[model samples]
Target: MKIDWKNKLTSRKFISAVTGVTIAVLAIFNVDNLTTEKVTALVSAIGLLAAYIVGEGYVDANRDK
Candidate 1:
């Protein structure tokens, strides 16, 4: 079976889940709060950028249809 990776990558839930998991792993390793926060922010920013890029690509692809 094939997976729709584009849809998964653009999903808010998937992004949130990834962020949550990242934070949890950091906490498990006793990472400092400041570093954890920074990591979380970076992950969120990257996720947003990825979602925006993928969404725009999809729109552009269908614009001429």
Candidate 2:
């Protein structure tokens, strides 16, 4: 099956997670304290982004019957 990059980029989950990760990255990189909450948040944000990307890839790959 052919994958649609545009569709993946426009995916809700993909966009949401990537945005969250981008914010977290910005905050963590700029913040002075890397507290437990900050670390947990960063991990969650990155995890969400990864999961969405993988999900989008999977859906795209299996779009054809």
Per-residue C-alpha lDDT of model 1 across residues 1-65, encoded as one tens digit per residue: 99999899879999999999999999999999999999999999999999999999999999989
Query: Could you tell me which 10 consecutive residues in candidate 2 have the lowest summed lDDT?
Result: 31-40
Please, what is the TM-score per model? 0.92, 0.45
Best by lDDT: 1
Q: Pick by TM-score: which candidate is best?
A: 1
What lDDT does candidate 1 reach at residue 64?
80
Tell me the tens digit of each residue's lDDT in model 2 across 1-65: 99987666656667566656766776777754456457656656665676677787778989974
Candidate 1 clashes between residue pairs 3 or more apart in a chain or in different chains: none
Question: What lDDT does each candidate get?
Answer: 0.96, 0.67
Q: Over 4 Å off in model 2, which ranges?
A: 1-34
Model 1 stretches with alpha carbons more than 4 Å out: none
